[model samples]
Target: MKLPKRPKQHILETASYKLFSSKIPDEWIIRDITERDYGIDCYLEMVNDDNELSGDLALIQLKSKDEIEWTNKDTFTHYGVDISTTNYWYQFPIPVFIFIGDISNQKLYFNSVHYTIKRNFDQFVKQTTFPYKFKKSDLFEGKDGVFAFKFHYYYEKYRQQFENELRFFISNLQHYKDFQQLHNNLDYHLGLEDTDQIFFESMHKNFSFLCTYFNIDNPIPKLRDIKKKSREKFGNESHYELYEHDLTEWMEEYEKLTINLIVGMKSFLNGELPYWLRINPTIYNYVNNIGDDGTLPYE
Candidate 1:
C-alpha cells in the first residue's frame, strides 16, 4: 500500500529528532518543525558550550523520485528560495541552510546560505559545491545565519535519506516471505520466545511517534487494509495506473507517500529490537502476575 508524504516526512523527522535528542545534550532543542513555507522548517536553539545563544535554522525541500531528476536548481535552495542570491540569510539572526535528499537521484547535498555572500569574490568558486562535513561550531558563532541554515539543511538531508530508505522497504508489499525470514532472524538474535506482541507493539510505538509528528489522525492502517487496498490498486498488475483524470497532483503525491509509509513500517517490524523484547518487556519487568520466562501468556 502507498503512504502519504506529510506523515512520512513527519515520521522520519521525529525519529531522527528523538535519536538526536537522546544521544545529544538536553539543552539543544528542536522546535517549530513543520512543512511551513519559505521559513525554516526546523530550528535548533541552545546556549553553546561557550554560553552563547547559538541558534540554527534550516529549510527542507522534498523531491519525489521523478522530481529528483527533473527538478531545476531552485530545488536545491534552502526553503525552496535562493538565500545566497537574495542575501536573506543575513537579514535574520538565524543562519540558513538548505537540504536536498533525492532518492531517485540518490544525491544528498548540503550548502550554506553564505554561498551567496562570498560568491561574488574571486575565491568563491568553491562555494558552488556541496560539502560532506560541515563544522557546526563555526557556523553557530556571531549572528552568522549561514551556520544555522547549514545545520538545518544537513539535518533535513539526513532525515530525507533515512525516510527514503525506510520507504523503499515499505514499498515492497508483496514480499511477506522476506519479512517473515527477517522476523525469525530477529527473534533468534534477541533470544525471544513470544515475538508477536513485541513485534507489533514496538512497531505500534514507532508508528505512533510518526503519526504524532505529522499530526496524522489516521496513521496506523491495519495490515489487512493494506492488502485490500493493494489489491484494489494493483490487482494482478505489476505497476500502478497513473491517470491524470482520476487523481489530483497533491493526491497522487499523498498516495505514494502513504504507500512508502506502509512498506517502511512493515520493514521496521522485522528488526532485531522488537524481536528481542517480544514487545512486552515493560509488562514482563514492571507488572506482577506476568507469564513465565518473559513470553506473554497468549504468545
Candidate 2:
C-alpha cells in the first residue's frame, strides 16, 4: 500500500492513540492498519488487561481535505464501503473514532443531512442487520457503533484552483516537506484546536460558492469597508489600523496563515503530493500527466 502522508492533525490523533495503547500490556495486541480498498485508513487494536483478544477493535477515521465543507454522502459512502466489506475480525461491534481537523470551532451539521444517509443505509443494510444499532444522533454520538466521521479543516485560499486542478495539487502534495511544514506552521499559529472556536464562530457555510470555484474555504472579506473604517478610527495609520484595532495581537496569527498558504503553492509546483487522489485509476493517470499549463499528456 502506498501510504500517503496525512495532515498534522491526523498524525497527532493517531499518535495519541498509539501512546494510549502503549500503556496497555503486551498481551493486548495493538497494530496500525491501513485498509485502502475499504477506505478504512488507520486504527489500533485494543486488547484486554488479561492479555486476551476479547474481540475488540478500535478504528480511527482520518480525513485530510482543503475545505471545511463535508457532505453526508462523503462520510456515508466512505465508511459504508469499508464496513460493507467482509471482515471476520471486525465482525463484532467496533468503536469508530473520528479525528478531525478544525473541530475546535466548527459544529458539523451531520444529523441535519445525515438522515438522508441513514435512510439510504437502512435500505442498503436491509437484508443484513448487525447486532449494533445505527445512530440517528448528531455528529458526535458516543457508543460502540459503526462509522465515525472527522477531518482537519483548513482555509488555504492562495492555492485555490478549479476542483480538478486542486485535487491534483492535493494528491501531489504528499511528498513535499515544505508544504507539510507550511501546514504545521499554520496550525501552530492559528491555534487549530477546539473545533468549535475554529469553525462555529465564523461564516463557514457561506463559502460554498467559493469552494465550488476555488477549491478552498477562502472568502473575500469586505476589505474595502474595513479599510475605510480603519481610516476613520486610527487616521492615516489605517493600513496598520486594521490589525491594531480589529485583531489587537493577531498579527502573528494572520502572518503565519497567510505565509503558509503562499509557501504551500510554491511547494505544489515542485510536485509535493506525488499523485492526485483519484476516484479511479484512469482519472488519476490522466490528471497526473497534465503539465504546468494545465494541458494533459505532459510529454
Candidate 3:
C-alpha cells in the first residue's frame, strides 16, 4: 500500500527554528505562535548580551516547498496571498517577513510583506493577478553564519536615505524670508482662510510623517494638555492673550526640539553619538514640554 504524503509543515518549522537559533544563539529568540490561525506563524525577539529583551520584534510567516521555479534572475514567484491577508500584514505593529524554505535544498529566502504590499497597492486595487516576487539577497545575511535579526538594521538603512532627502527639505525651509513672501502672495491670491488651511495641512503632513518614521506618538494630546494647563493658570486671561502667550511659547519650544532632534540624528549617523542617546526619553520631553534643562537627562 502506498503511504500518504506526509505534511511538510513540521519539517519547515523545524528547519526555520534551527537555522535562526544556530545563527544568533544568544541575541535572538524565536517563539511559535500556535494560537493564531491568521497570517503570522512565529514571532522573533532580539535580546541584549545579557539576555534582556531589546524591544525589537518581528512577525514571521513561513512557506516550504520542494521546488520553486524562478520566474526571473534572482526572483521567484510567491502566490496565494489574498487582498485581506495583504492588508492585515501591512498593519502589523512590527516588521513581518515571509520566509520561503526550500525543504529539499535546505535554503531559505524571504521578503518584507510591508514593502511587497506597498509596491503593488495600485495593481492590487485593479484586481490584477500579479505574482509576488523577491530577490534572493533579500534574505538576512551576516558574518560567521550569524545574522542581525533586529528590524532597526533595516529601518536605519531606510533612514539614512531618508535623511538625505530631509536635508533638501531643511534647506528649503531655511529660506524663511522667501517662504514668508510666498505666504503673502498666496494670501493675496487665495483667501486668508484658504492660505491658513493650506499652510496648516502641509505642517500636519510633514509632522505626521516624522512621527511615524521615528515611532513617536502623536503630539496633539500633549499640545492640548499645555493649553489646559495654561487656561487653569491664567483663568482671567482673554483667549487671544492665552494664544499669544501660552501657545506661542509652546510653538517655540517645539521648534527648538525639532531642530535639536534633526541635529542629534545627524550626529548619531556620523557615529558621534550613541543610538540610545539619539532617541532618549529626555529628547521625548520636547514633545511633552516637561523639562527645560539643556543637558540630556539620561546617562
Candidate 4:
C-alpha cells in the first residue's frame, strides 16, 4: 500500500499558521477553515481576559514569506494581487486582514484589504496585479493588546449602518471626560508615556470633521512636543519623572482650552444629539417668521 505524501506547500502553510497562533493571546481561538477553499484561511475569535468571548471577530488571509523586506525602504509593505481577487475581497461583509508573516525573524505584517479598496478604489480598479501598500506602523509589535483592541474598533465601525455616521461624529465629540481629567491633573504629565502619544493620535484622527465642530487650536501637538522632550531626557524609563521643559506658561491655557472643548462637547451632547436623533427643525432654524407676514421675506 502507498502512503500519502505532504508537499512543500503544506509545510509552508502549516508553518505560517503556527506563527500566527503564537502571536495572538492564548485566550483567543483560531478555527482553521482552510479546507473550505474560499479566500479565507481562518476565523479568529477573541476571548476576553475575563474568560468570556468578546464577540470580536475578523477574517484572516494568511500568507507566509521568509525574511520579509519592505518594498520601499521602511515606509510600507506592498503585496501584489490580481484585481479580481481584490474585487472578491471587497465583497466581504466583515473586515478581511491580509496577514503576511516573516517566518525567519518572527514578525507579522498586516493591513485591511477593504481599507485598500476604500482608500484607492479609483486607481485600484484601473490596474491588475497591483501592489497594495500596507502601513509599516501596523506591523505587529508582539506585545500589548493594542492590535486586538484596534481590530474590534475597526470591526465595530464596519458593522455600523451608514445612518450612524453622524451619531459616531457626535459620539466622538461627547466623550472627552477622561482626557479632561488628565488635563487638570498636573502630576500626570511629569513624563512621556505611550498613552500620551496615543492621546495625540486619537484626538486628531477625526480632525478634518473636528475642525468643523471645534475651531480651537489643537493642544495635542504641544503636549506631544513636551512628551518628545521628556523622551529625550528620560527615555521610556518612567512616566513620573519631572519634565525638564517648563509647563507654567501653557498648563493653564491648555486647561482652559480643554475646558472650552468640554463645554462645546456638552453643548453638542445636550443640544445637537437630540436634534440629530429626532431632527426638530425649529431648534436649528435661523429665519424668524412673523404673524403679520408683511415685512421682508428673510430675517
- Of the two candidates 1 and 2, the one with more favorable TM-score, higher being better, is 1
lDDT of 4 by residue, 37-82 (tens): 5668898886665979877677887887776677665655455566
Comparing 1 and 2 by lDDT, which wins?
A: 1
| Structural RMSD, model 3 | 15.0
Model 3 TM-score, 2 decimals: 0.48
Q: Give the per-residue lDDT digits (tens) of candidate 3, residues 32-146.
A: 7766568787887767658898676778777767766665596887876776776677666567877776656656666766555444555555555535685666555464223
In candidate 1, what are the lDDT values of residues 135-234, reduced to their tens digit? 2232222345434443444433344343444443333322422333344323221222334434433444444444433334543455455435545654
TM-score of each: 0.25, 0.22, 0.48, 0.51
Assess the local accuracy of residue 155 in candidate 2 as a C-alpha lDDT between 0 and 100. 20
Give me the runs in candidate 3 sitting further than 4 Å from their true place.
1-5, 9-17, 20-25, 48-51, 127-130, 144-172, 175-299
- For candidate 3, the per-residue lDDT at 181 reads 38
Model 4 bad stretches (over 4 Å)? 1-7, 34-36, 148-156, 167-299
Measured on C-alpha atoms, candidate 4 has an lDDT of: 0.56
* Inter-residue clash pairs, candidate 3: none
Residue 166, model 2: lDDT of: 45
State residue 134's C-alpha deviation in candidate 4, in Å.
3.2
